[model samples]
Target: MDPVGYSHDEKGVSKEPQHVISEGDHGADTELRRLLSTRHLTMIALGSSIGMGLWLGSGESLSSGGPAGIFIGYVLAGSMIWSVSHSIGEMAVMYPLPSAFVQWTGKFVDPSAAFALGWAYWFSYCITIANELQGIVTVLSFWTDKVPVAAWITIFLVVIVLINVCAVSVFGEVEVIASSIKFGWIFVVIISMIVISAGGAPNHEAVGFRYWNSSPFTHGFKGFLNVLPTCIFAMSGSENSGLVAAETANPRKSVPRAIGSIWLRLSLFYLLGSLMVTINVSPYNPDIFGGSGTNASPFVIAYREAGLQPLAHIMNAVIFISVLSTGSISGYGGSRTTMGLAHLGMAPRQFARADKTGRPWLGLLVTLVLGGGLAYLNVNNSASNVFTWFSNLTSLFTLFGWGMICFSHIRMRYTWKLQGRDVAELPWKSWTYPYAAWWGLIWCMVLMVVEFYLAVWPLGKPSSAKTFFANYVSVIAILVLYFGARLYYRGPWWVDASTIDLDAHRRFYADKDPEAKKTGFKAKTSKTLGFIFN
Candidate 1:
């Protein structure tokens, strides 16, 4: 019997527990659906990543890093993400599945990794949903200061619950529409700002680098690092992607096609977007963000400051859409993570249950309850700071997950080489390996260290001490829950490799005639779409 990737239910009881794929709970009526298209997956990656981070939080990065500093961060982070995307792309082509990451973590590494990494990664999604809930409430305040944040939180939770309960294709369609709105709004914002800054307006005579000269980033290196908390926070949803693997139509093509260009997409979204914004808007007054007055989308700020008409309200509505898009995505991501954890046995069995539509109904419910409860915190006076506390604490965990991805790729590379595999034949290869992986690991480590110091330093920085301690506490708590549970059950380290079927995954790749028989509802719809498209 294998330790985890393919083991029995009774706590690894048998010496040779059947090594066959457990007629997985979710894919019962079908040979696990292959539903996503490259176009759908690519849009998903773009949509999931290019949101609230840019529309809502780019200002923070601009103010902190300046145009140059922010670009540096995005380019660096984007490069590392590129390596990750390629690594994922290669494996995704080889064996695409719904819970591909979870399966891969278990198969290539160990069950303990699958349990720990999956759960921790899932927890990040959960925490982010709470954070986004807070954002929605904050944005809604623009229209109505009278309604309590808690009420808005409930409203958004209901929206997410309804969406989650819908059929999977409905979920996919919502994603498509939501992504369209976000990308559309961001493009509009960037273009409008660039034009406003270039032409002379009524009162402000063509503000050209005025803000940059006025600010000139006098804060130095440490200050640059200091404001990076949100910069990191902005890019949080990239990993939110693996959640959709179970639903992707053709895992091999779709996952790679979707996950492959992370670097380029994020660069344009984060790097190019920030440059336009910083050059257009005031750098970082902290006064413009939310305190008083119109609190314009900084793009609107740049425009109106240049004597443009009241564009702030328009941008506000756009931001509302962006938040809704991101919040919905956040919920979907959290629910999938919960489902993955349950299916993998790290969570309660009930949480793994899905409705007839393959919706993880219980998982979605739990995420709602948790996310809703967190939103209730918005009514508290300290809600804003608490939001910061949670937001600041998350990047380290993201760094860890990415680092594991790099490690997993290294392991996969070793395994591939061990079997005398040819690099040229691989679908996608991570560049300058040993080099790229090492550099990425170093970058991830540096971010962690800087973040750790930011959390603990007590250098008279207010949020650092508590944030550091709390972040560590959450990580430790996650570790304890995963390893402690594993030890209590006394699970073995490795499973019979043969039991972990890569054949089903390979079949999807091998079959030239993709128009095969219907597997289930998801497959039928996907097949219909493929027939139409192909």
Candidate 2:
């Protein structure tokens, strides 16, 4: 299929074609509808990243790493995420393919790398769906245990599945709304924490740096190292914008703008939230480590500490919605990755079929059904433990997925230079040639090492075989996939730069597409938040 075609309206604004998917169209190359605008791209990217990772996982980080440890760990993770975004953002602008990085690695690096990373990334998000479903059950338990865990899982699973099966426009709108709510709630949490920190709450007790002074590092360096995996998990979904590049109407503008704003979200939402949580609540609070849901969230705990129980209830509700939103994103990412695998001939072709609305119905069904089935694992075992295990395993996949992304960027850049391509001719370029990508790649490697050490010698318990495999299983799976693909394809370990087809699937924004010239309320709103959405 050709790239999504656009036509200009009477007002000179770009409009998407209303072409419905043909019933006979079952090819892997069917083009997705370019209904997602710049605003949709920005909002969905933010929405996807600000889920259970920040709301619930931060509590685990606080318990293990103390206030200072979580803050510093997020800072480090934020930096690495910045690099990954730029690295992929630059490439997405050039290729603008569905599941951009998976295709990029195969095109610029090696087909085997793409096969391995594609499946690994798909599994990570698939497990994320299960994890978030479990998270929903845990958050609901904060209110009452009257509803059975399976009941809540079924309800939300159906809701998320509905969202995924609809048109990309509907998916984009739902994400935009969810992201707007999350964005507003984050500010409320931050402002309330500031007030509570300054002795402005009902108790009139100032929690000014008390936790930091008392226990900055709960277990010292080992504890700080322990927080890295949690940080990795929390920062995992920032790449969703790049994944939907094909569906985005103006990737040349929207992809970079969407990724360019990650730093702002990281600083304002993640880093600031981490700092506030550290100040407002003591890391020693038993609740910090008790639950795997909102009850343990630093934001909720902060409000509870400030004697604002009602707001804590509201926070829990918001986080519950946030988890569901994350589940929606997980389905979106996982299905697209499945479609990408099929397109690359790495998976069965039937999975690539899209429905009338350009929804990858077969892939979406597989992702949600399997993911929802996995959610049942919590019914018998401890929900919290299952959540933790799933999170740790996914984090390991995130490490490899992100590392390969940056590595692909490095290879792409070297190939571009070797081909004597003019940097100015490219639509977008990474912030720093090679350096940022290198930093991101090295950070992922270091975190994997940290994960390995923790897997062998956990913070307190005796190293067990279960713990080791739990952490390293994703790494082992990726290696197996890589080698399996290698044996089947028999391609070079690293793709030759000279032989790379840089022009294959590369999108050039010239006179044909007028999407960048769009004007409307959404574009104006984007301009108002220009610092981020520009």
Candidate 3:
């Protein structure tokens, strides 16, 4: 057998990869079903990324980084994400394999790297689940403190788990509906911001560029760098589009289309949203710093400050929904990643178990039990504090995951050249070859160093051992996983690019028709809406 677990016959035809699960438990349909349509892929890409990181945590970003700091930070982060999307899209279109990055790292890089990255990446999603749950507790407090935080956490936890453990079609439909609601709410918020900036509020005060003018940058260059972590948090899940390729009906078409649209989503939703927040809300507002619920949201703060009290309430409710949408996405991402780890034999075989409906129920249960359970930390610590802890950890892990993606892409490209393969043979090619990959990898390292600086001296706070270790624990965890896997597996630190089995699990052999089948008005409508829902 090859190092990646697939063997080839004398004729060079690839055999099926070895399975970790036993035959008795491997009932019919062991793989996730390709039931998700292009619509589902597009919406998941858009919705999974629009979460508490923007709605509530942006307030903390503004408080620490100020208006210009965050706006610039997001711009840089957006570019880095663009590179990552393209790099992953190229590979996903060709492989269309389960556990997208995990498999890629194992095949193209090294098995040890795959084992380490797989677990860390899964834990990142888990942390995101916990972060969103904590956001829900904070958002709900806007309406009533009479209800216990634990009650709301439990209610939403059950709801998300159910959504994830069902057939993926159910999960896809739910995401489309939830994503639509989030899109509408964000549109309303952006338009409201524009109107309010132009003195449309009852107070008739044009706050045009007032916040930016007062203090565009906070805490200087360090403050701008500090904002990068929150930017990573906000844009963390765009790569999940590639992760779902194996579950998509037509990954060659849908995955590239979805990945290609990431730039537009980042530009419209995240970039514009952050810009509006900066223009409408003052960074120095006491309420924007360390409060709970909608009171801490810059959007809600801007509305209330403009005397638009009712709008503030409506915004908070929408934010509550946004939290649920993201929490559900986190669950989906976590379960799938855990299942991928199991398939790679990096985890227990039971984690790979799926029901007849093709739901990874056991993995979903584990994610809910471990990841969802972290939400209860709000019972002891303040919701904002817990949010900060998870966000910091998640953001660091995201950087590492993205960096590895770029590194893997670089290694794959080198191997492709050594194998005498033509770039034209690829189903989808990255927009800019080695440059995009290098750009992403370089920025990831730069930001990792920035995180270290902030860990030592947090924004607007004195340096403390507690703060430093808390911020770096995520980094330490990944290093531990990587070295531990190396010690156990006793494999080469890095696989030789020349020896990589590039053809393993590759979905395409001889090229077929590049054009997709168009049916009727529905297909035409889908094609017409390709700009958004491709």
**Maximum-lDDT candidate:** 2
Per-residue lDDT tens digits for candidate 2, residues 1-534, read 111243455855333344322112222135566778888988877778787788888888888899999999999999998899998889887777677788788777777888899999988988999999988987887778999889999999999999988888899889888898988888898888899999999989997999899999999999999888888888888888888777876677688778867877998889998898899877767775344444467788888878999999999889988899999999999988887777677778776777767788878888899899999998997765786788889899898888988998988888989999988877887767688899999989988988899999988778999889976788889999999888887835776787665775566565433444658987667556763553
The lDDT per prediction is 0.62, 0.81, 0.80
Alpha-carbon RMSD to native, per candidate: 5.7, 7.1, 4.0
TM-score-wise, the better of 1 and 3 is 3
In model 3, how many backbone clashes occur? 0
Candidate 3 per-residue lDDT over residues 347-381, each given as its tens digit: 78787777666688877887778877788888998
Whole-model alpha-carbon lDDT for candidate 2: 0.81
Q: Give me the displacement of residue 11 in model 3, in angstroms.
A: 18
Worst 10-residue lDDT window for candidate 2 reads 19-28
Overall local distance difference test of candidate 1: 0.62
lDDT of 1 by residue, 392-485 (tens): 6566567767777676666777766666667776655545577776666777778877876666652235765445676555567557756765
lDDT of 2 at 507: 66
Candidate 2 Cα misplacement greater than 4 A, ranges: 1-29, 289-295, 512-534
